[model samples]
Structures are given as structure tokens and as C-alpha cells.
Target: MPPPPRRRGSSRGKILDLIRTTGPISRVELAEMTGLTQATISTSVRELLRDGLVSETGRGESTGGKPRTSLEINPAARLGIGLHIGRDYTTYIVADLAGTVVGRLRVAGVGDSEPESAITRMAEDIEQLLDGLDVDRGAIVGVGIATPGPLDRDAGAIMGAPALGAWTGFPLAATLSEATGFTCTFDNDATAAAIGEFWLGATGGYNTYASVYMGAGIGVGIVIDGTIYHGKQANVGELGHITVDAMGPTCACGNVGCVELYAGPQAVIDAAHEAVEHGELDMEFTGRITADFDRIADLALNGDATASAIFARSAEYLAAGIVSMVNLIDVQLVVLAGSAFQTIGSLYARTIAQRLGERAFARAVQTVDVRMSVNGTDAAALGAATLVLQDRLSPRSLASITLA
Candidate 1:
């Protein structure tokens, strides 16, 4: 998603940017492509080569002159770790400079646990994960975390994530940094999913898209011109809390009619529990929400009408959210990601696509591509890893760019 269209500003940023976007190319080509003088290109390339960011990858065709040496990124030079602490599970991954995941691990169901205990365990896991890989500790850029948010990203503190109440006000990034001795960066899972999709996902080349992430809650990660829409505190992906029914139950965030209150997995489970309590539907439950949700999803998949209806009702609320998002953002693509979509994803995808086709404001001139993530449920974790790559490899301005 990076290597900006403009090649004149930030010479080193531009050179590395070109190498990333254009693939392996010679100094002559970089100079010609970026419109920078040969001397400037040479200087920048030398610094990059010395820093182990770029490598001479062989040779290129000789255009009536000597064959030029080709250069490309050294993917193994730098490594990054991305972690997502979800309600149902914790996913961790290590990626190299190319944003390719080289290692991964998972711990099931951590949202209800204490933040300090969960993080301490995760730090130990990182140490073990590092030992299995051949990369040096010095080459590690840092750790990137994607958790449910309304967090203070700069302060490394989490706030307002209802499921992570114990994590509220916890110094997440700083704590992880101190425990691991590597710098850490954090962002909401939704934005992280969008970043991962743009950089390493099949959603490549499509700069403007929305990634609807479902976990403990639902969020919309909006990407425009290859850049994520965010600020220092949090992001604009709280579309899950967008009001859909003014009369709906109040959310912990103090909003009534919030989409998550009606359509999130928890909402669906709560509805099912209510149905059971009222004797409207008969279904086995373990008194655990996670297990109950899984049971309901399996029943729906196996042709249980009641279970199917539950998902349908939830999808309706979610579609209302999609409609609002399209009307406001006018995006042509919407991707579904996160654990909530792990089972009945097709139902949501179908409902969203159908609704957009029927009612999206831009449907007349543009069609929305509503689809599920090809990366499966790991979109957020992989995207978390990309955060470190963007911060370490590309200049802040270039990695997230507005292209013409």
C-alpha cells in the first residue's frame, strides 16, 4: 500500500519506497523512475545497502550499455511481532521486513482474564517463539498489538473496550515493552485488519476499502488511498457503535441503538439465551457464552431453523450498519474479518451484499464488493505485524499515502 506516487520528497524514503513498490530494479532504473539525480540515488542506495534494508539481487538487461545491478529488500533483515488479544483467543505472529509471517502461536480465550496476567503469559510466549527462530534479537524491530479499542494508543493504555474492562487504563504497550525489552506499538484490531489487508492481503491494489472486523465487538476499519483513517488516540472504526435503533438496549459505552448491542456475537448469544429462558426455542447450552455461540453456529450450519433465524436477525442489524457506512464513506469494497465471522460468516456476507445491492447510496454508480477475508481469522494478527513493518521500513508519510 506504500511507496508514494511522488518521488521528489524524502530521498531515502523515496528510494526504499520505490524498491518496495516497483520490485527489484537497478540504480539506473530507480534514478529514472524517481526522477532523482544519479548522485542522490547512489547515495541513498548506499545507505540502504549498508543498513541491510536492500540487497543486490543480481542483474538487469543492458540497454545498449553495461548490465545494471538489481536491488530489492532484504526481507530477513528486520523482524516484527503482531499480537491480538481477543475475547475468544489470542493470536501472535512474527513477520519479516516483507510482511511475510514466519512464525505464529495462539492461546484460546483471553478476554475475561486479567490484563496483567494475560500480558505476562504472552511475554513468556514471545521469548519461546523467539528461541525457535534463527533471527537475531537485535534485528527485531518491535511488537505491535491489536486489541479491541477506544484506547490511548500513544500512552499504551486501553480504555472503553467493554470486554477488556480489566485492561482499561492498563499501560499495555509500555508494559509489553518493559517486559520484552523491545519497543511496542498498539492500535485497534479493526484498523490493524485494514492495514494487514492492504499490505499483505489479496485485497492488494485496492486502496480504498472497509474491513468490518467482528470480535468481542464489531468495528469498521476504513482505508482510503492506501492509508488508514486514524489519529493519536484511537480511530474512526467505531462504526459498530453506530446507532441503528434509538430504542435498542443501552451499550456499556452509553449508546442506545448501537449496532453491536443488536448484531455482535455477544448480542446474538444474549438473544439466544433470552429465547431459551422464555421457552421459545429449545437448545443445549453450557452456560458459557463462547460455547453457546459455537453450538448455535453449528446448528445453523447443519440446518436448524431457529439458529439460522438468530443469525438472520443479527445480520439485519449489521446490514443497517453497512448501509450507514456506505452512505457516509462511499467505499466500493467491504471485507469481513475477525472471530465473530469465523462460522456464520457467509450469512453475514450474503446479507450485507444483498442489502448493499438493494439500498447502498452509491449502488447506482458503484457496486460494493462484500467478501470474507482470504486470510481467515488471522487478519487482525497479521495486520498487527504490518504495523511494525510500516513504522520501521517506510516513512510515516509514505506507508499510508493518498495517491493521485
Candidate 2:
């Protein structure tokens, strides 16, 4: 049997993508924007119109002789799904081709659950959410799953996640595809969050950038030349496990004095709990660590010396990690994301910016921009959705799949 023919880019696809991103444009304008002839643009636009992907909304003002028709993408033409899997919860959302979320479902965490059980529950939840929506299932192009590292991108299995125990080596993408009967894409949560910011957040137009995700652990995703740089094994950006202090503390990844051990949410909670046990502060530490971090951030914001000191220590470790990243990658911007960053974001921003300005290798050449992610809690999930959109609509940059 002969191999199936390769799928190449079609003129219609290119024109449609242009209209989707920068639309309400006339045929002549599209030709000028894409460097295609007027006849080619007209034919592509006509095909898009016939497929219900583009529509003529109105008439544009005449540039020379007659008015031209304005073309725009029909956002209702297709849909995509994004799923963010964290230790505490699983977030599911449906978005249109334009990246507008139409539905959302947040399920309570699946802590310590076996991989199969957790994925089964997640698949059911996704099905229920999709069934409730009025849109046709055919409109859903694919699903994106974002989780912590280290991951085997080709095998679609999580190598090991500190928070999500018993998930290591599970065939996540294959299992989900079997259950849902739709193509699935899996990526590191931080990478997904970074790309999410580029597609839907405020980090656009920046050439080089880093997205720092602080959850149960720390992860960094780097973007250069508008493309994510995943090194060999798709785990190049494991910034959390980098050794910061040779004698600081033992990390879950078996490394001594890693940054995550000193600055992750667990570290903060451990410090707070120790303080509470020693008659320092009257507070509960047995509950959720994130809530505890939020409390600490609130107290610090309100001028509590103990809380302020704790956050300062955390920020210092985070700054050291940022300095290492800047020196190595030479990124121009760093964005903070996840719940932990949201709590003490301003402190992190100030501390990292100051340290980078003083110590970065490229400080004399270019200023490194550092700030918190505008997407906040929704970054990972939204980025997951973008994976689907890219797979279905934007094919040039999609990650190639390797079967097991």
C-alpha cells in the first residue's frame, strides 16, 4: 500500500488565517498584506465564503475607484478544548477558533489518584461539559492537555510530577484520545502557559521572553523568535530543579539546594508552619498550601513583618533562578504565572527586576523586561486550548507527533 499523501498549505488556509488574525480587510488589501495577486486573493476569499469560514460584512471606502468588500472570519465556524491538570484541580474550557472561551468547568483536585482513574474522571467531566453545550461536537477540532514535567513528548507520558503522584510514565495522550475519540496534544504546563500569553495575553511583540510558572513546583518556558524552544527530550526549561544553594535544602527531584526546595509553595508553607508551631503567628497550616500562601501574601501586604520576611526570602531564591535564566537565555522579558506568583507577584517582580538589572550578562546591551502574566490563573488552561487551535487551523508551527 502507498503512503498517504502529505497535507500541504492551501492558499485558502493562508488567506483565512490572515483574515482571522487581521480581518475586515478588502481583497486588494489582503493581496498587499500577503504579497499575493488580486485574483488569488479573490479566489481564496470566495472559497472561504463558500465554506462559511469568511463573510463579507460591509464595504470599505474606495482607495482609488470603486469600494471593496471587507472580509472577516466567522468565529462560529469551529471550536477547541483546553484542559489544565494540576495537583489541586483540573480546569476544562471550550474556545472558538478566535480563542474566545465559551464554556468552563473546574473540578476538585485528583490528589494521589492513579493515572487511569484521574484521566477517566477528567474524560467524563469533559464529555459532560461538551454535551451540555449547544455547539456540534464536529466543531471541536482537538484537545490540549497541560501538566507538569518532566514529560515524554513523543510517548505522551508524564515522566514524573511531584504533586501528581502515580502519573509517571502514563500514556496520557493515547488514553485520552481513546476515551474522547479526538486528537490530543500534551505539553508542559509552563510552556502551555507561556504560549497562552502569546496567543491570548499581553506578551505580544516581545522577541525574547520567559514565562515562570510557580505552582506546587517551579517551571520556566522560554520563547525566542516567536517560537518555543524545547530542547532535546522536550524538557529544556526545567528551571526549578537548578541548584541554587549547595547546602540549602534537599529537593524532591533528589537534588540538593534546588530553587524549588527553597521557593516553591511547599517551602513557604513549611516555613509558615514552623513559625506557627514556635509561637510566632496564630494561624492554621494544615489546610491547602495555596490558601496559606495567599494568607501570607495578604499579611505581608498589610505590613506584617513576619509575613514580609518570609516572602522576601522566597523572592530572593526566585531572583537567583531568574538571574541564571537571563544569563543563559538572554531573554528580554520574564512573565510570572500560576497561583503562587499571583500571591506575591509584585514582590517577585521588583526583586527579579532589580537583580536582573544588576547581574544579567546582557544588562549593558539590552534591558530585560520582567512582569507578572496578565492571564494569571487562566494561562495554562487557555494555552492548552491554543494547542488545539494551532493543530486544526495553524499547521505550520504545530509540534510533530511521534508514535510509540
Candidate 3:
């Protein structure tokens, strides 16, 4: 068997990162940006060019004398794969060095299947995707997996994700790595979303922010001091399970009146179904009412009294949850994200903003900024891909820190 690849940091890696982030620059500019000497930058660029990872794109216009050669990262030199493991489906995307997705594959409903079987299928799907693309295998750096929490990051296993029953204690990262022969990394879906927003969305400059991910369940990803806080055991941000009403409804986590029980998509659909069943409305909703929730939002937006009441109640619970979070963390910004938030996000944003203004303990000091996630359907997946990028480029050791 082939020996494991050597793991060593090199000047070429840092140079590649700099070029990928800010390219079309001269070696002198790179030296200035990286604090490396001009001779070192030229040496690293030569190695990168030899490896086909970078190239001299063109000559920069001369400022004083002869035009300097502009160095740029070869977008085709490397690829990163991002996989978002949702409750119902997995989304796979191949992104270039520039963070642009050039190829994609969607795998639907593998959550109910056995873990090994699902992983095997996922591996096959990835192979198929790679087979179809013209990208070189050597250029593929690694894969990133975004799964629902709570997860054991050290073990790379899913603990007890309700949406993915077959994934309990599954060694997802190792399985993918063994199957594909590539380095693999794992992160919580919500945290991945926040990183995605920072890396590719509008939250780059925001220091303290919260990414409220509303999917099969609600999860909040906190960014304090420009870094994601993954508290003890990678299970810190369980915003969905935050208690909103002591006597409300029972949640899947065996808690009563959790925020998710009131504001999650399932809860909204259940309310609508109950309303329909009790002759209060005439909309039939049986299984997985994603579309039905949108129908309720439309009705509320269109001035239907009953639907408006239901949405308002849900929004109230959502606001209460956000207010509680704000009082605890005092973050300046909150970004609403997830597939469910795509349609009715404005209603949630308005409710959360108003409640934060009125009731948060920090209201006297500062106002919490609530906004929608800039990346719509692809936030989680894109964030997952960014895990690979961060693992490779970012200075901090995300794996070593214990979140609060």
C-alpha cells in the first residue's frame, strides 16, 4: 500500500492562500502583505508555478519603471468538496480556489438508510461527480462534511440527530476519508453556516453576530470576536431546545415548550394541520409540510386572520428565544438562515428585532441587529466547504478551542 502523504507546512501553502484571497498582485505586494522577503516570495512563487498552483497572469501597469509581473492562483489547480448532510438530503458541491462552485450533486433522503449504506452511496455519488468533471484528482485537496448536531467533533461522529436517525454515532468523516482517500473535516451545520456567511456572505466585517439556522430544527451559531464559538463537546448552540413556554408542547428532546416546538417549521405545519382538521381552515397537510408552512406564511402575508394569528404566535416565541439569547450573549447582530427561512424570513426578522429592542437586558446599552443570511439555499453547504478552507488557511486552531 502507498504510505500516508507527508504533512508539513510550506511557504508555498501560505503564498497560495495569499494569492487565492488577493491575487493579480506582484511578488513585492505579496511580500508586503505576507511579511515575507521579496526573495522568499519569488522562491515560493517559482515552486507554485512549477506545481501548476500559480501562474504569472500578466504584467502590472508600470508605476515608475518596467511593469512588474502579476502573480495569481490557478483556480483550476485545486478543488474542495462541501457536503451538507440535511435531515432529508445531502448536497455536494465542488468549489474552486476562488470559492466558486463549479460542479454540484444532490443526494436525496439518505438519512433514513443505514449509516454504512448511506456513506457508500455518498462515496459513489462523489465518484460519479468527479468522473463527470474535467478536474484533476491530484488537485482535489479535501472534503468538508456539515452535519446536524449534537456531534462529537473529536470522534467525528453524529451523536443523536433526530432528522438523521441512521447517523447516531456514525463515524462520518473517517468513512468519507477512507472511501475517497482525502482529508476530511466535520463541523456543525449552523457553525458551518456562520463561517460560510463570513467567508462568502455579508457578515465578513461584523465582529459579534449570531447565525440563527432554522431547518429540521433551529440552531444558533455564535461568532464572538470574529470566530465561531463551538462550546463544550461541539454542542453549544442548541437554540432550538431553548425553553420558551413551560407548559407549551413536548419537544423531541423530551423538553416541554421548547422554542423549536413553537417556531420550527414542523410546529408551524402541525398548527396548520390542526387548524385544518378542526374545521378552522381547509388546507390539507399530511407529510413533511415544507410547502404547507409557506402556504401559511402566504396567508398571513395576504391578510388571513387565522393564519396571521398562528404566524404571529410562532413569531412571538421566536422573538422570545432571540431576546433570551441577546440577553445572554449581547451580540450586535443576528442573521436568520436555513431553507425554511427563505420564504418567511422577513416576518421572523421583524418580530425578533422588535422584541430585542423592547425586552433585551442590553436594550439600554445597545440594539441587536437582526438580518437575513445573505447566502440563501447554499449557506450551510458553502459553510461546510469553508471548513476545509479554514482548516488549511486560517491561523487559529478551531479544533483546539473549547467554545463557551
For 278-373, candidate 1 gives per-residue lDDT tens digits of: 876678777555567778899889997777899999999899999989898888789999877888899999999999999998788988898898
* Pick by TM-score: 2 or 3, better one: 2
**Candidate 3 per-residue lDDT over residues 1-404, each given as its tens digit:** 98444344455666776676677888888888778888888888888799777789899889998899998878777778888887566788887777778788876747467888888888888899889998888878788888778899888998888787678887899998998888898888888888777765466456788898887788988888755787656687889899988888787788888998888888888888788888886665536545577778788788877788888888899889888988898798999888778887888899999999999997898878888988776778877776786575433456432111
**Shift in Å, residue 173, candidate 2:** 1.1
Candidate 1 total steric clashes: 1
Candidates 1 and 3, the one with greater lDDT: 1
The CA lDDT of each predicted structure is 0.81, 0.80, 0.79
Better of 1 and 2 by TM-score: 1
The better candidate by lDDT, 1 or 2, is: 1
Best by lDDT: 1
Against the true structure, whose TM-score is highest? Answer: 1
lDDT of 3 at 320: 91
Clashing residue pairs in candidate 2 (N, C-alpha, C atoms within 3 angstroms): none
Question: Residue 290 deviation, candidate 2, in Å?
Answer: 2.4
lDDT measured at residue 187 in model 3 versus the true structure, 0 to 100: 88
TM-score of each: 0.90, 0.89, 0.84
